[model samples]
Target: MRAAVVISPLASAVLAGCVVSQTQGGAEHLAAPDGAVYEGVDTRLLDGELVNFVVAMRGARGPDDVTAYAECAAAQYALIRGYGFARQVRTTVDEKNGAWTGDAVYTISPALPRGTRTIDAEVVVAACRENGIPTV
Candidate 1:
C-alpha cells in the first residue's frame, strides 16, 4: 500500500513566490537602481584606422558602465566610417563625485580586427540602443 500526499493552496502559493524571487535576484543584474545620466562622447581620429573615444556619465555602477559607453561610441563610429568591425586597444576609467569617465582606443577595419576584443559594429550599436546607451 502507498500513501498519497497533498499540498494546500497556501503552500503552493508560497512555493511559487520562492521561485519568482529566485529568478529575480542574481549576479547578472547590473542595471542602475536610479536613472543614469549620460553626459556625452568625444571622438577623435588618432591615425589611419585608430580612434579615441572619451565618454562621461553620472550614476554609473562601476567602470564597466563607462567602458560600455566608450564601446558604444566606437561601434557607431566604425559603422559611420563604413567599417564592419572594431578592436578595442585599451580603456581607462575614472570616477569622481558620482561622475564617471572612460577613455578608450579602438582600431576600425573592414574585416574583423586582429584581437580578442573585437566588436561587430552593427550588433553593438543595436545592443546600445536597446540598453538606452547613446552612440556616436
Candidate 2:
C-alpha cells in the first residue's frame, strides 16, 4: 500500500497576497494557493544519474507546499526515466513576497541510498497519484 499525501491547512491557506496551487498536466504545476500562476517542475538531467529539479509556486506559498511539490515531481521524473529509487542530495527552499520555490538535486538509482533522507521512487509516485498529484 502507498501512503497518501495530504495538504495541511496551514499549507493550503492562501491569503490575497498569495496564489493557490492548481492542477496541470494531470497534476499541480506548482500553483500558488492564492491562485497566482507559477512555473511547473523543471527536471534537468545531470552527470552520473543526478537530477536537478525546480518547482515554483506563485504568491508566497508555504515551505511545506514547496517540498511536497518538489518531491512529487522527483518521484514522477524518476519513474519516467525507468528508475526505481532516488536520494536527495540537497534542497534549497525559498519563499519571497510573491513566490515559493524548491530547488533540489537528487541521485536516481535501482536501490535506495544507504543513508540520509532517501526515498523510494515507485512508492512516492504511487503516493502522489493517490493524492491526485500527477506522475510522469
Per-residue lDDT over 1-136 for candidate 2, one digit per residue giving the tens place of the 0 to 100 score: 8444333221232222233444421123333245545478888888878999898876534565566667767777877888877766777888777677889888887765554445677666655554444443
- Model 2 poorest ten-residue lDDT run: 8-17
Model 2, residue 59: distance off in Å is 6.1
* Model 2: residue 102 alpha-carbon error in angstroms: 1.0
Candidate with maximal TM-score? 1
What's the TM-score of every candidate structure?
A: 0.76, 0.66
RMSD of each: 14.1, 9.1
Tens-place lDDT digits, model 1, residues 11-96: 22233442111122111122222589999999999999999999999988777667777877888999999998888888899998
